[model samples]
Target chain A: MSATNRQIRLAARPVGEVDPEDWEHCAGPVDEPGPGRFAGRTRAISLDPAMRGWLDDRPSYLPPVGIGEVMRAGSVIEVTASDHPDFQPGDHVVGTFGVQEYVVSDGRGAMKIDTSLAPPSTYLGALGMPGMTAYFGLLDVGALKDGETVVVSGAAGAVGTIAGQIAKAKGCRVVGIAGGPEKCAMLTDELGFDAAIDYRADDVRKALRRHAPDGIDVYFDNVGGDILDAALTRLAMHARVVVCGAISQYNNDTPVKGPSNYLSLLVRRARMEGFVVFDYADRYAQAARDIAAWIADGRIKVKEHIVQGSVDDFPETLQMLFRGENVGKLVLELV
Target chain B: MSATNRQIRLAARPVGEVDPEDWEHCAGPVDEPGPGRFAGRTRAISLDPAMRGWLDDRPSYLPPVGIGEVMRAGSVIEVTASDHPDFQPGDHVVGTFGVQEYVVSDGRGAMKIDTSLAPPSTYLGALGMPGMTAYFGLLDVGALKDGETVVVSGAAGAVGTIAGQIAKAKGCRVVGIAGGPEKCAMLTDELGFDAAIDYRADDVRKALRRHAPDGIDVYFDNVGGDILDAALTRLAMHARVVVCGAISQYNNDTPVKGPSNYLSLLVRRARMEGFVVFDYADRYAQAARDIAAWIADGRIKVKEHIVQGSVDDFPETLQMLFRGENVGKLVLELV
Candidate 1:
């Protein structure tokens, strides 16, 4: 079986905003499935802030993507060719398949998605990596308990939306901090959040004080900047600040804005910890099952901000995250 | 018994250095032992940096010492009179008996000390609160393991000296930071520390880099500020910074200089935690036994910087800590 694949490769590392010249579109013929590998047609791609970190050459959790390698991404693909024992052709699969029209993998870190339950992009968003990040970050790392108040920044983004829902399901009073009124309304109305702070209009610290009268027990910080400083002020005793992502300072020309009010941790006996989704790999099965059950019960809302585009449009699609233009999850549907 | 008891009372809170005007000496009649009470004559008073935190009118783990109350101090006292069956007249005891020549207590939070094994002064200095703070802070809070590198600030002081010894005893490489060359020499030569960084004479970060090239696994910080900043830059993965005290910033008229490099906690997956000694009250028996055993075997050296003075000299005794004039555990022996 011959499959033509259109791939987006990193031409150069971006300076600030990723320029169009930074990515090059390359087309090639996809080969037959190897002894253990399978070939699939790509459907939707996931855009994440960690994608920016993977581009910079520094000692981080992961190495930088090489210039010649296909731009790293998590995507949903339709399985068309398979020779491995675990899978068959026509099965819907999801994994880190890069920015390509077709993907061939050796069944490592790949999950079979039943679109009959949720859409293909949903597996790439709410039920996948970002979902797992929010789950473990708030519940395990943050040590969230019932009746505790949770305040999540980037409340309308992929991780924040899922985190709020998970905390709400766990019987927590959840408050969300989002940029616009629309996103704020979406957090409170669409998701089961107790309160939403419009950070664009209201003062973050004052909003936190009003919403969390007893102070926040858990702070799920995705956009770390002045907002993180604002949250630091209202942390209660034994509060946990989960550092899932720092979107606010990822593209900073200078150093990231260090939280000046960190002494609050000492005063409140609080803790701030960071986590990567890879650590939760062994427990994903249980988490995915729980999330799927929650979705089936209409307890969690799945929001996918899908952009219909070709492989060359990958760089532009990623910019949507930095600009805060995408709602729930930003996905590039290969055309 | 008509004992002429001299008690140091807090006259006023000081703005910077504690002055004689801040304290008032009262010559009062010795409190007689009532039913189920014991009257003890103070032998040695434990002068600790934590005594400063008790003077502040802010909320902490314990209630602040009131304006006209006797200054709180841990003391080794010999019971001169007893109406309680649990304690005898000749029994040596360790308890928070205030800065006074005589004390009367109902035997709560008071542990009987045996002078047959060690000196009564050792109960207030080494085998006492400072020793317990060092043991628990280094082992429990710091989670120290064998073969790891331990860096301690205020290395010549009571808690620091014991912490360094305990880390060394656990088969760890220990580095200490002290004010002068003499204290540095005492730390390495006398206290069994692997290396000593004289903060007054050498660059602390440079010394740490040279000594603990693999990065510090645990840092017990007593003298916070730039020393804490230096230690922050050298933390290994999952490093624990035990906030035993911050004496360096205690008497500052200005706000404490916070360590700006604290984000190293995130980069290294480290933590900084504060705890009051009272939190481990139930485990003091375990600590005293272990520390006394270590001292007996010469695994830990017991050093007491005893200042022979009356209760009226309490203000001047407290100032020695801020001035860094005393080494090991500073205690006031009533003369």
Candidate 2:
């Protein structure tokens, strides 16, 4: 076990796109598992677009990460020491453990995972927060019906990939919108998407009209902007627009561009709803089971973009999400 | 009855605001009621913000008014002659009978109204389409709960007045937003809104924060634009934004200004939904009963801006709605 731990702390609030100056890399004494607690070494850290929202001094589902604090993150860690009865040495756990080499938890929000079922990185990606987010946001908030046509923005990303696949599993026709032709091809060729629109190459509104001639019944939005406006113009009657995340607008210095064509909701009698995944904490186990079954049956494919690096790479690695440089779930795997 | 029926027809589609040149004032021979049909003299016409949408060539809840056609309008008419068994000469009926001195109908979409309970103009205001719009849009689409904080835009207009009063009748704290001080005052003093914000005089966001300090549970949006954006910033968790109309953007030559702060919906876990009141047709009678009782018990006050004029006045009277010149319901009553 390492005698010291490396950590990345928030140095300052970012104005627009995050800068290296905003993060401070430092060393700290590794925490010991005190009474009723367990200590673990982080194996993988999740890089999510939603993390950008936590950097600003504003109100959100979760409080902003304060300056001089270890940045908040979801990670999978392997237990090295324990003073708790439920947790033992070598047990893998998933929790909001911050951007650090190690973690000490009292089992408040930590869940032990079976590494034999899937690797630790999978827990941080397909079997973890992103998985639960796609499940609930697409099924519950979206109110998706079988055989309905679905259009998902940021389809090459974490939640979008899972959401699109879930819709396919439910017998729906799914169309994906991503930045590049390679990502678009991966969506249709590998992920079972019926069609894919390279937003960089196609007029999205015209492409949507051609791909979804009947109109989009459910639009799982991960990247909001003109793509959202495009999806709005093609909504079927009583369509559901699930507000997942806005990766495209996360790094903007100006205000997030609202959907100009949102009034189409009135003409089509549709609705747009937003939600946080933590709200469905009670049902996570059931959703995990369902997702596991889909993966086993070959209906769902796990996609991860793993970057082998130290804790110092987190700030730079996170920028890749906003730039659309990574495909599927972006993760940092410590060697 | 006059041998010539005076009519207003759509001349050319207006680019921005409807100009005088967009209307054609003409006279036509009054047609007799055919088999199983009825004819009536137009008594009062309802001037609505939705009329502007009908002038634009776009897909909407209803089709646009074609050129050279009698401009479509909702009005109350007194039956002068009938070949239909359900109608009588002295009975008063309401329907989309267009902007004309006389109307010939097959009795389709026509509802017999009781003038003994209310005046003919009142049927075009408080007991008509606008009234039903408020009833369904607020209670159904808004999912309003008793004692909740409700914010309504365009609160002195037809639907706004009824919506504010209905929220007040349900024991909710209602904040109204209107253009001028008089309209704002009328909302609080006469219509029973708890507070009022004059958008023209006060900073709307600040006013909303002061009035709905705990956050707005339901926002019934009649005017979408900056006011909608302001309401969005003050939403409580699980808030419902009922998209009823966008009178503020109806006549804009530029694209409708989207609510820039709409991502507040995600932070607050809220929803914005739109509906056409016609979808709730089966429940109109029940809602009308509730609204009528509230009015009778003095929990609701009816305010009308009646312009006594001939069919030639239709074009000018509609401008009052867009200019925010009239309070409560704006109606053109034929002499």
Candidate 3:
């Protein structure tokens, strides 16, 4: 066992946006597996915008992380030793294994990953939790239909990339909203989006009006706030607004302000439903299989933005998510 | 042809609540029906709270009543003569025949009624348009299920009365919100509700907590404003809030105030949907047949409040509604 292992821990509660001071680097000895526990080394750590919400103390679908705890993260790891019968040494496992190079697990939430079909990093992106989330959130919760116009915000992010692709595969006209020209270009050129609106420069409402002239049938909202209101104004009758994430408002110091024009629900007879992907854990394999099939057929493109860094870079990498710097799935490839 | 006929015309638009000055009595000669029409003597006129919305110039699901027009109403009339193949002399018909002593129609929007089931007034009450509204709104839009807890506002009104009875017949435990002790007593005793809350005297939230201690499954809201918010707070997971009519807020001079606690929809994973009864016109006959079967089998009881008056008494009879003096269905029987 290694005498020294380094991990990033939450040093303080972040205010507004996360700062480097919010984390503390610690070194400790890697532990061997007990009777039921297994140990692994983290290969890639996922950086999701939802992590910002987990850092704040508030009422959400999940509880916030306590101070001094290993910062919460989803990771692709290789088991070096195992005691559990369901797993073995040299098996690639994926789970919420925290911000560390080495992790020991009881195999409670870990899942064996196939490195042949894609790679360890793809498990942290297109064929993993975010992909399954986009699939279920769009298809099951949104109840998307063929030829329906889909408007997705945070369109360059992990879930958004897969969501836009899945909608396109379902015979839908997809509109992507992202931050920069390059991201918007990637959405249109690479991700098969019909239209891409740079939320940084364009008026969202005007862009939505122009791109989705028939009005939005399903608005997959990852960036909430003004974008949500803009989408609400352009909803067709019986439209469904899927609240997958609210990256824009998650880091606010004050009380989260909701959209004011929500009466559009009554005016348009539309519905807005919020769901957590964790709710569909048992059905994730179904989403993964379908997504993999689509990828195999060249109907869905996989995009993962991998950053090479040490475990100590976890705090800074998470900050990149809130700043809208990373395109597609943002993940830290551990050295 | 009857030369003597009297009608009530809209005199002035009410700024808030309808007052006596808002109505005008006008006399007109009763015209004879043409080759494809029927002449009916107006026996009873239904007074519904929704009639207030028709007076406004704003856009609604239905067109607003034009200035200086006959006040719109659902009428139970006895056919005196007919050239229409579907209607015959001495046949009782229900139509949107306005507030008048006589009406002539070319068989359009008219349905023949059988007086053998109940009395002529009950058609304007328990088995009429309000009854159909309650039936379809509760069953189809609300998606009510057996043994669910149903909380309805305006519990002593025509539609509310039948809605509670129908829910009871479907094995739902019903709670009603009314204005006074007498109305509440009738809702519990005569209407067979599980409990009744008098909103005028009692606190709505506390009453709901006491009556529906397990949380509400379906909320049939007829009176909006604070009552809607109160019900929204008590909704269990996946609860359906049916927006039938907002009687309490109909009198507001400014824009109707929306409920501030609507974030509850997100919290409960519930839905709040608004529907106009006219949307279900194609399925009214189907709803009527099912509702009639229940009434015939003694599963549901009919309640009617009849007020006998001359055509000139229309103005005064309408005031009885705003005063909350009538129970069940408030029908003005032209005597």
Top DockQ: which candidate number? Answer: 2
lDDT for each residue of candidate 3 in A1-335, tens digit (9 for 90 to 100)? 64677898899999998888899999978989889888889999998888887887765556898899998999989998988887799999999999988999999889999899888889989988889889988998899999999999999999999999999999999999999999999999988899999988999999999999988999998987778878878888778888787788878776454654454565566777766777789998888999999999999888888899999888877878888989888999988
| 1 or 2, greater by TM-score | 2
Compose the digit string of candidate 1's lDDT tens values, residues A1-335.
45567898888887766778888889888867889988888888999988987887766667799897898999998888888888789889999999998888999989888999888888888888988988888888888999899999998999999999999999999999998989988998889799999888999999889999999999999988889889988988878888777888788766556675555665676777766677778998889899888888988888889999887788888988999999998888877
Query: Each model's fnat?
Result: 0.10, 0.72, 0.11
lDDT by residue for model 3 (B1-335), tens: 53677998888888898877888888899888889999989999888988888888865656787768899989989998788999998999998999889889987888888999777887777777888889987998899999999999988888898899999999999999999999999888877899999999999999999999988989998887789888977888778888788887777886555664554565566776666677788988888887789889877777777889877787677767767788888888888
Against the reference, the lDDT scores of all candidates come to 0.85, 0.93, 0.85
How do these models rank on lDDT, best leading?
Answer: 2, 1, 3
> What is the TM-score (0 to 1) of chain A in model 3?
0.98
lDDT of 2 at A208: 100
The segments of candidate 2 whose C-alpha lies over 4 angstroms from its true place after superposition are none
lDDT of 3: 0.85
Query: Each prediction's TM-score against the native?
Result: 0.84, 0.98, 0.82
Docking class of 2: high
- Which candidate should be chosen as best, given lDDT against the real structure? 2
lDDT of 1 at B123: 84
DockQ-wise, the better of 1 and 2 is 2
Q: Is candidate 2 or candidate 3 better by lDDT?
A: 2
Model 1 chain A weakest lDDT span, ten residues long:
A255-264
Q: What digit string (tens of lDDT, one per residue) describes model 2 on residues B1-335?
A: 55899999999999999999999999999999989999999999989999999999999999999999999999999999999999989889999999999999998889999999988877877778888999999888998999999999999999999999999889999999998888888888777788999999999999999999999999999999988998999999999999999998998999988888888888898999999988988888897788788889998788999999999999888998898999989999998
